[model samples]
Target: MSPTTKNAGGDRAGGLRGELTPRRITALAAAVIALVFVFENTKEVEIRLLIPEVTMPLWLALLAVGVVGVLCGVLLVRRRG
Candidate 1:
């Protein structure tokens, strides 16, 4: 019956619908679909660098790339500091 309680209820309802415009939803959906191809089950594949061939499981390759990216970001930040 309190005025503050009514205001809080209205705010919660608004939040459930989200605050994003239609454009944000389309962009997010496209990004997720694109990543689906990157993580989908794939057999070991060979990547050729220079004159050498490196064979690795698709998932392992993805994990290594992600870790390398994080390390690079950290190094860059430390160097900047």
Candidate 2:
């Protein structure tokens, strides 16, 4: 098949089809790095939001921020696409 041709599964027959793209691999790697960073830091840290301060484990704070980041990314993608 030609490089530009598509298969029935809607994938490029001679290109990356049902395969992990560079973007996907990069995302996976970033996720792994983030997880490792989160898990490595277990110390209690004080977080300040606006005028309020709260103390929690660093891992929990990191996880929460990660979740919020993921949610924001999802929302933006959904709105645009």
Candidate 3:
């Protein structure tokens, strides 16, 4: 191979070498566990607010809350940064 092509391939391989570290593996495992937890609780339940009530599957409610919490966290971080 030419020197230019060899250098390019090495750079690309180096960029990907550290893509999966211990911390990333742990985060992936945690995400899988969270998904399992969300799917297992499939019962319906009542959710009460100030003046209204709603019935939905337990997993859906939990997933919504999780999404909202993540959005709030991202917003706070962005504001701080």
lDDT per model vs. reference: 0.72, 0.90, 0.83
Best-performing candidate as measured by lDDT: 2
In the range 1-81, model 3's lDDT, one tens digit per residue, is 765666534665655466688988996898788889999999999998678999999999889998898789888878641
As for candidate 1, its clashing pairs are: none
Candidate 1 residue-wise lDDT, 1-81, digit = tens: 865666635665655376778888886886577467557846798988689999987867776776687689778878541
TM-score of each: 0.43, 0.69, 0.66
Error of 1 at 75 (Å): 0.7
TM-score of 2: 0.69
Model 2's lDDT to the true fold? 0.90
Segments of candidate 2 deviating more than 4 angstroms: 1-17, 79-81
Model 1 compared with the native: what TM-score? 0.43
lDDT of 3: 0.83
- How big is the positional error of residue 37 in model 3, measured in Å on the Cα after superposition? 0.6
Off by over 4 Å in 1: 1-39, 79-81
Q: Per-residue alpha-carbon lDDT of model 2 for 13-59, expressed as tens digits?
A: 55655679899899999999999999999999999988999999999
**Which pairs of residues clash in candidate 3, taking residues 3 or more apart in a chain or in different chains?**
none
- Residue 57, candidate 1: Cα error in Å is 0.8
* Each model's backbone clash number: 0, 0, 0
